[model samples]
Target: MKDGRHLVWILDDEWNSHELEKSMYNQHGFEVKVTRSDKLEDDMPLYAPCADGVVAQVGFQCRADVIDKLQSCKVISVSGAGYNHVDIEAATQKGIMVSNVPDYCAEEVSNHTLALILTVTRRLASYNRKVREGKWDPLDTMPIHRLSENTVGLLGFGRIARMVAAKLKPFGVRILVHDDFVTEETFNVHGVEPVSLNDLLQQSNILSLHVPLTTETNNLINYERLKMMPRGAFVINTCRGGVINEADLETAIKEGHISGAGLDVLEIEPPSPDHPLLKMDEVFITPHSSYLSEESIDELRTRTTQAVIDGVHGKHLPYALNQVKTETKI
Candidate 1:
């Protein structure tokens, strides 16, 4: 602690200002240090040994080497839903709680997923480009199917995926979901049919992925899976990009098996200019901003700060992703 106040390190440098973080932590009788580093892992040595709590941004690596160096850190709170960046196993063994704010951006990401779904389903981009080029015919983008006739399938029935289902209910589309963790009653309550992964792929006219990236899910949507979908099927991914093999996806789209795609995240952020997907007019890529909105940003900051505050105060960390045998607390 610094000056008898708990010291929290904000290991995030992407944000424009730390005023919100400072004000929140300060009001709770905590001292906040803002660390800026292009390589947080390389600079972890300077902050880990003294930080009472650490707030790490999404995509920041908190590997075992860095996590083992944390001397006083009670908790490492990830500011986003995905905690794959952190070494949860190492933190657990070190008695440091690992938490994430999964629900903070549920509305924003679900809305973004819906937006991508509509963008590809309606062929909006194709028409806009045609209209801009002085073409007036709607037939410029042919083979557009009615949304009501499309069967939308969700790979995971998490908070965001459920919200996506709620939003799509009015559209008269049949929604199928596949999640091993979800119970049958939950699927019934949501009016969605739970199917095997194979059935989901074979039947969905529009497949939207929401599962986190893991060894089991990496490249889950490859060329073989793409072939299972009906011809001209559109793929949407607002979650982890590694879930789909970029190379296989390009090949499927090139072979005209998969129609088009709306991708908010890619296997690599700011993919190199020569990335094959960059040249595909059938693909729409966003800079992984699915969880962005002023409201969501404020909520994210508030919840992330709360986790640190709880940890520093010796309270159980909220939204904890892992269990620890002991937590270093005041």
Candidate 2:
């Protein structure tokens, strides 16, 4: 929309290279400029504000102050499913569309979710530690339950959660879900039982959180909620870390009420070395890698660029998260 070409600013630090984005934008007659700064407020130059579109990564927060500086920005394409990093309200008010690639890593994340479930349920990590410590006895970690006997509860029924349900079907485990937004027909189609939040907390033998982090969901699984689960219940979270109160989780685990947990994310990224959960043998942690895969990354980049392209051309944004009016068009 500027200088006879669409201008895109890549404000991201997660990826190693912007060659993919640059190539994609260049093919569409667009000029792409990248700022590999994780913190835009401290690092972005003032002249960088005149972008027609933006491609953002999780590490960069496009807050109200930052969004206000984008004088010509028509759209912002977040490179991943979660758009929590972007100030959606500010963008909408500024007539800038916000889009996210929600389905790009569905398979990868679902696979990681199932893997974490199995790792905790089967006591794989505990046994592995024992074996390494020269303890060679299966009874060292007994009471391993069959996956079919344990009820697996999914916190949300979005694309990733539904894919998880489909993957869990062949395992024959009873799946319970608690998402007020999801209809009963969705539960029936997936052969999952729809339950109230209280029931979900009380009945699930293994609970996996898949909800987004918002005001309502932040610290949703606090001390009281964790206590509601059956004693010795396992917890799995592939979603946002803020959804669970980390301090309360540690207390519940220390009290032996919650048996174990598989966490792909934490309230803090790269948690401190002395973090209580990190030292617990009952807890397993992955470095926020649930959504990683070569194919997934490729798809994410392609879709994210396409979103900006569509937005600058005044076409409907396929993965739009907010409504906005823009004057820029092809």
The count of backbone overlaps in candidate 2 is 0
Q: Which candidate tops TM-score?
A: 1
lDDT of 2 by residue, 55-155 (tens): 88885877888888887888899988888889999999888999999898999999999999999889999899889999999987877888898898999
Question: Which 10-residue window of candidate 1 scores lowest in summed lDDT?
Answer: 321-330
Q: What would the TM-score be for candidate 2 when compared with the true structure?
A: 0.96
Q: Which stretches of candidate 1 lie above 4 Å from their native place?
A: 39-43, 327-330
Q: Name the weakest run of 10 consecutive residues (lDDT summed) in model 2.
A: 38-47
Q: How accurate is candidate 2 locally (lDDT)?
A: 0.89
Off by over 4 Å in 2: 1-4, 38-43, 326-330
For model 1, residues 92-177, the per-residue Cα lDDT tens digits are 88889889999988999999999998888788888888889988998767788989999999999999999999999999999999
